[model samples]
Target: MTIPQEAIEAGAQTLFEESQELDQDNSWDDELPEEWREAWRYAAQSALTAALPALERQIREQVAQEVEELKLNPKDSTTPHCVEEYNAGLTNAAKIARGKDQA
Candidate 1:
């Protein structure tokens, strides 16, 4: 199944911003260690990788519950569909971790 462009962009934005935060020291004048910054960036990126879909799942579940409460259809497909999306994220994360070209 195709994921939304907004979701991909949002995930990329979150990963980049968090990586930047991990690499910066606002209180400092000199640059951070190159090695350390790279390491931290990848670490934060991976953590975001694992977290984004899980976070999305929890949020989707809560919203689904709310919709069920109101006897309305939820915003998503079935649980298996959501799991497929989550697995896709995990697969993409692995590709990224391997430095594979997405194209």
Candidate 2:
């Protein structure tokens, strides 16, 4: 199945929002000086912000690759059920046409 662009955007937005929330209320690095911890947080946030585009691109590429693989080798559950129904409809139409022609 193709991953919708909206889903990808939501995933990326979640990552960015979570990253923003990091170190907001918790002190995880007790060993480090307060200044060091603050600096580390700043650097981490900046790195994540700068890398957001690349991260989104990677997510898109990975999803596309998985979708292509599924298309090439779909499992029984993933196979289209509508194809059989469509074929059956065509057969019914042909039979009706044949009956009309004979009449």
Candidate 3:
């Protein structure tokens, strides 16, 4: 399965953001040796690198599930809303599957 560059970038950004939050005081990693911190950072980045494809797949599956749910709930008076949501989810899922950005 081809994972989108956008998804990879997003995953990396998320990691970075979370790390930033964890280090809000700018000293969260200060207790560790510099080399150890470097190694830990490398490991974290490597993990993110390895997990991006699976993450993309998870996103696709979740979108598909949402679309299916919307389809199954057509009995409600919000048919138009459900249809719109289903279409949007399906479209986003297709885009992710194809390694493309949402339209």
Candidate 4:
């Protein structure tokens, strides 16, 4: 299944923001010049952008593997009750990954 672009962006943005917060909370960052901080952020964003495709591929592969295992040995009474439930599961997973949902 193709993950939504919005979900991917949200996850990436969350990660970037957390990194920034960590940097800010570090006492060493206070001595750093604004230029240096900006450069670090730029490099971080660039690295994340470059890694997105591989990250997405890995997520997809893992999800597919889990789905296959479920098909082979499903614990639920049904594979999925309906398409809406399946979509909800995907949406909920995205939310949890993005730190927008507790469960």
Off by over 4 Å in 3: 1-30, 72-103
Instruction: Evaluate model 3: give its lDDT.
Output: 0.61
Q: Estimate, for each residue in 12-39, the C-alpha lDDT of model 3 and write its tens digit.
A: 4555557768775434335646664555
For residue 36, model 3's alpha carbon misses the true position, in angstroms, by 1.1
Stretches > 4 Å off in candidate 2: 1-30, 72-103
User: What 10-residue stretch in candidate 1 is worst by lDDT?
Assistant: 66-75
> On lDDT, who's better, 1 or 2?
1
| Cα TM-score per model | 0.35, 0.40, 0.43, 0.43
Worst 10 contiguous positions by lDDT, candidate 2 = 67-76
Residue-wise C-alpha lDDT for candidate 1, range 12-80, written one tens digit per residue: 445556656889433222464666445545655565666767676666566544433433222454666
Better candidate by lDDT, 1 or 3: 3
lDDT of 2 at 51: 70
What's the count of clashing pairs in each model shown? Answer: 0, 0, 0, 0
Model 4 segments beyond 4 Å from truth?
1-27, 72-103
- lDDT order, best first, reads 3, 4, 1, 2
In angstroms, how far off is 84's CA in candidate 1? Answer: 30
Best by lDDT: 3
Cα error of candidate 2 at position 62, Å: 0.8
Model 3 pairs in collision: none
TM-score of 2: 0.40
Candidate 2 lDDT over residue span 1-103, tens digit each:
3344554444444544565577354333235366744555555555566777776666656654543343321234454566445545554544443332311
RMSD of each: 14.1, 15.8, 9.2, 11.5
